[model samples]
Target: MTLFFAIVALAFAAVIFMQQPKFGKMPTGDRLERIKRSPNYKNGAFQNLSPTPSFTDGANFFTVMREFFFGGDPRIKPTDTIPHVETDLRNLPIDEQVLIWFGHSSYFMQVDGKRILVDPVLSGGASPLSFTTRSFAGTDAYAVSDLPPIDYLFITHDHWDHLDHETLKKLRSTVKAVICPLGVGAHLEYWDYDPAIIHEEDWNQTIALDDHFMAYTTPARHFSGRGFRRNQTLWTSYVLQTPSMRIFIGGDSGYDSHFAEIGRTFGGFDLAILENGQYNKSWRHIHTMPDEVLRAAADLKAKNVFPVHSSKFPLATHAWDEPLIKIVQAAEKTDLRLLTPMIGQVVHLDDSTQVFSHWWEGVN
Candidate 1:
């Protein structure tokens, strides 16, 4: 009877904790209705296009926790401060079509005269608690204040690492509109963002941002949630077509057939910004492995692949620089160019010939 009471008490405590504003609310009312209409939503939650087990057949969360707590690589994080270049995002000339990666999956792009910020987590940490999943030294330099007025904010999903509530709340005033996967708007709405500016969408839907800017929502082999209950919202990738560029905003996805299908549908991307870190064989179905990153890029038919989801936070147990090293090694055997810029270093989209030094080299 005591054990039962203890379990009940813990569960109740968990429920109360999740009600905090930083945790964000799930979809309700109209948003819930819209999510229900999505083809991806199944049973009681959103389903990946492919069968995606959180871990492999044999291993589960306990095994993962054990690995994290015991057998993780020795250099799971960097011994040295991560190298960076602090570009003045507020003063970046609109005439220059470029992208500045703020380490990991967050980036700012100015293309065809529009400023786009994707998954900006500038809060120096990525977990629900400030002490955990902390951003590496010298990587979290660009805060919300440094950014220009955001014309569009694209949130791939509501993972704490991607869609940070604190960051979003800070950015509310400067942000014009949010383009996110379905049901993610609930969080924004709960945070006091005007519902009219939220253009949340499902996979395969095309959003005409303007006369020449079109965004097509696409499938991703991942799940989404900010709290305990998972997959209540959709996870998505995007095929963004500007007046002169077609960029694939691959938020976070495991290697899957969807890459080829998206490539065929949109006729490939000039640059594919794909996740290439925080991966392990245990959760291989959700995060792309190093070797699989190149394959996924090839499948996307990308002319240039920009690897992300690393360098900022140690979300996985792999060595800090493994993703960049492996991706670079993988790219050497292929014809596709790689966009490997330092964190906050600008990559001029017009200048495909611009070379980036092996910045991670020699940095322990």
Candidate 2:
């Protein structure tokens, strides 16, 4: 009887822990009604354009878990402190069109006089539980306190790393508007944000921020969920168009024809920011490989390409420096200009001639 009671107590505690606010509330009421209306929604959850298995052929859950736990690379986490710059974002001149990356898919950009924050996860951990997926040393330099008043917050999806609940809660007061994919607004509303400012969009929909600035929600071959239920919210990429420059924000995607489709539709882009790490053959249909990243850039017809989504968290088994090393080598054969900035390094948006150092070299 005592053992039974102790087991029940433990289960109760686990339930309570999972119910914490950071877990975020799921779509409900009218939000669910709207979600059901989406053409992309079917069989009770959002579906990808292409059939994307979380694991590929011959890959089982138990096998993958075992490999991740015991057979992964030793260099998955950096041994030395990853270097970064500390920029004064709040005080930077508004006219200076620049971008500051905060590592692992989070970045700040000033374009067409609009201040944009994308997929910001500054809570130091990418997982729901703070103890897991922690950021590398010196990479946690930009906290919510370091941010300026944001004109637009772009959340590509609801992944724990990209749509961080703790960071969003703290950023509520500073953000004027949030542009997210469909069904994602549910989380923001649950967090007490004004519904009027949370703009949710479907694939191929366009939001004209003004005559000079427009945002287009494009397709991404990825999946999304906060908990056990998957693909409840749409994952996406974005095309941001200004009077003088067009940019493609490839949030998280696998190699697909959508890159070429977007390139054709938009004509071309000045810059393309794409995911370049945390990938394996076990899940090849979801995350692009290093070589595939270059192909994606070429498909987008981007003049300059910036590879991100690595160097902070150890989400895959590859050596920490492998992505950088492979991508740099692959880029040499292509005409596509690559941007390899350190965390917090400011990149001038309009300057094609600007240069950045290969900061990842020789660092442990």
Clashing pairs in 1: none
Q: Cα-based RMSD of the predictions, in order?
A: 1.2, 1.7
Any residue pairs clashing in model 2, and if so which? none
- What does candidate 1 score in Cα RMSD to the true structure? 1.2
Alpha carbon deviation, residue 84, candidate 2 (Å): 0.8
Q: How many residue pairs clash in each candidate?
A: 0, 0
Off by over 4 Å in 2: 1-12
| CA lDDT of every candidate | 0.91, 0.91
Model 2 residue 123 lDDT? 87
lDDT of 2 by residue, 1-364 (tens): 9999999999888788878877777888888899899999999988888788889868978878988999899989999999999999999998898999999899999987888999999989999778999999989999999999999899999998899988999999999989999989988988989999988998999997767888999999999988778888889999998877998999999999999999999998999999999998898889999999999999998999999999999998888888989999999998989999999999998888889898988888
lDDT at 17 for candidate 1?
A: 81
Worst 10 residues of 1 by lDDT: 49-58
Question: Taking the tens digit of each residue's C-alpha lDDT, what string does model 1 give over 75-148?
Answer: 88888999999899889888989999998899999999999999999998899877899988989889898999
TM-score of each: 0.98, 0.96
- The candidate that achieves the highest TM-score relative to the unseen native structure: 1
Candidate 1 lDDT score at position 34: 83
